[model samples]
Target: KLQMTREEVLHDIAELTSYAKEHYSTVLFSAEDATRSDLNFLIKANQIAVENGATRINIPDTVGTITPNAFGYIVRKNYEALPKNVRIAVHCHNDFGLAVANTIAGFENGASEAQTTIIGLGERAGNASFEETAMSLYALYRIPMNINTRKIFPTAKLIESYCGGKIKIGRLQPLIGQNAFAHESGIHAHGMIKHARVYEPITPELIGIRRSDEVEQIVKQSIKLGKHTGGHALKAKLEDLGIHPTNEQFQKIFNHVKSFGDKGHEVMEEDFLAIVKDVMGELPEEEQYVKIDELTVLTGSVTPTSTVRLKIKNNGDQIEKTASSIGVGPVDASMKAIVKCFEPMSKVKLLEYNIDAITGGTDALGHVSIELMDLETNQIVQSSATHEDIVMSSVLALLKGLNKIMKDKNSKN
Candidate 1:
């Protein structure tokens, strides 16, 4: 925006540096957008500043468009234009998400000092993140600095709080993110269980998280369970919850969990506990007299309808029953069809029905919770289920709650 001629620019540099020389002993002369300037003109301007008593020359990637190699070249050209004692510094921005790389490249070339900001906060896309750049030097380059590596996270958090929501550290921010040290994938989690180095480049302990060698301790602290769960990861999770199931029950729980992951839930600890409670709670496998064999629903034009097939065990007899019904919607239709299937054995009334999307998107996880009342015993019970399809979610939740009351009143007796 400063459309000044070459002579005017050189005159300003000389006058400012000279005035600064009279009062200040050390002066840093920064040529803004130096990367886009003519290399020779930039070098001459830097020399003039040095001649006028400036001790440092800074090359700023002012719109942050310069490549790493180009920035390194500019810093090198300027560094050689002055006395060896004149410090060469560089400022980089992350417009292209390469501030850290450009900073390191400048240092590798001739610039010894890099201007950076905390959590990469600054003008426009922000300056280089000091923690990330510094760690890159310490861990990858093996160059030791005066920085306290362990304090990096605490300092980042303090700065994040100071921003007060204006600037927030991203969850995926390297080294400082919540999932930065988390291992969730089944394969990766198993590898981490075997050797921390297998999946992690460096120990998370270096960045403030406590170190743990025991598998249980590590899993509890760093492992997360989700739809991608494997036998190893699930076993670790179960161990963390202090729940021990027989091999058969464990297999059953695992399969149920896999089915529950139809919409890719991370399976929070509470969710895991709930799933375990459902499996180990009363009406365990052998006594599960009613099970949904298959459920299908159709809606949107012709009257919303559903077909439900269930397997029933009545006092040592195995029977299959199918029912079709229509309702106000597909979910309601599915519920009605299920109710019709079980009307002969036990009658129940739905007290409440609630559904919420646990995640985002059209096919995200739909959590269905329902309250049921067994008409025969007048007992009220609550059950919930999750699936990718809303109709299936409603059907599963209804069946779960129905089974709870029916098992207590009609099945055992």
Candidate 2:
């Protein structure tokens, strides 16, 4: 219908309304670009449709060009000009980023229903978002809605997945985005630690989500270690990690972290923990039973092999031993060699070994966590180490766990 005249549109609507009334229980007459239509003619068209049996009239901002105040004014005009029995609905687009605003405005003035889509999925700039509209209505206007708030995230995720790139949720999108409830800054985290409401408009639990304290603490510690750090903050972070370093050890760890920051390197949590371990010494005095003197590994297309030299202390005497082994990989071979060297103490078996890159890039920190079982004592222990070399990190973690098991056995004896 190019250059549709008001009279022609009204004549068509009257005929459609009459036909719809006989066959359908309800009829809705939607005026495309209603905001731009002649107000007087628009009112007449709506009245004719309602008189002929249309149940509702919808006013849509087709190109999304109208302001909230203007939209409210138009809705108010239609509300007054139309018959008292007719219902009004508003369909708004987000070209001007005011669809929700205009929708709420129209509802506040007189509209009874709103037209919305999930995550504002529609043509061009899209339509008003149901989540935004429903949440705003309930939270800001005190309007009670029967929406299940907990299902909001799950539903949004399903829709987003089905869209398959047609719609992308903004990282900072309100309520459901990844960063919606994430706090990165130390100041913000500090405030949130005291009272979450200070930084968050609503708790994540209200939306069926749980806040990650470990992630938040990692961010807070990263910021402090990467930028300017205070003694209190540093102490708190170390204490949180269950590492109560002595005064001298604290000074060394702090200086090492600051040096890394000054060199333009990110001091991650793993890096800080590694620094603390290096400064405080690997094992406590009583737990110092076995130590790695030297290790060499050879791998690649050829058979993987390793040689390990270890120093074991017993009754103030140091005994050194060397062992060699072959396995599927460098880490496996190294573990076999270390176990061979410590065969006299206990039958130590590496039950589990896991490694993760703590940071990006080829020089990323490799964090190795291992679970060791002492078959002789039937005791299990877990420990971890972080380093740039995966094999060394794994060996160190295994040795740490072995030391714990040996220390416990000695204390019992």
Best by lDDT: 1
Against the true structure, candidate 1 reaches a TM-score of 0.82
Superposed by TM-score, candidate 2 places the C-alpha of residue 7 at a distance from the truth, in angstroms, of 0.9
Error of 2 at 31 (Å): 0.6
TM-score of 2: 0.61
lDDT of 2 by residue, 232-341 (tens): 55666777777888786788777766665666666666787776775565566556788999999999988999999998876567899899999999999999999999
Count of backbone collisions in candidate 2: 0
lDDT of 1 at 310: 96
Backbone clashes in model 1, listed as residue pairs = none
What is the lDDT for 253 in model 2? 73
Tell me the lDDT of model 1 at 367: 74
Tens-digit per-residue lDDT, 1-413, candidate 1: 87999999999999999999999998999998988999999999999999999999998998889999888888877777779999998899999999999999998888878899889999889999988888898999898788888888888899999988888888789988878878777898898889888887878778666765567777887887666677888787787888888887688678766765645556665556656765565356776778999987888878998898999877678789999999999988899999999988788899999988765566556677889988887889998876667787788788788777656865457
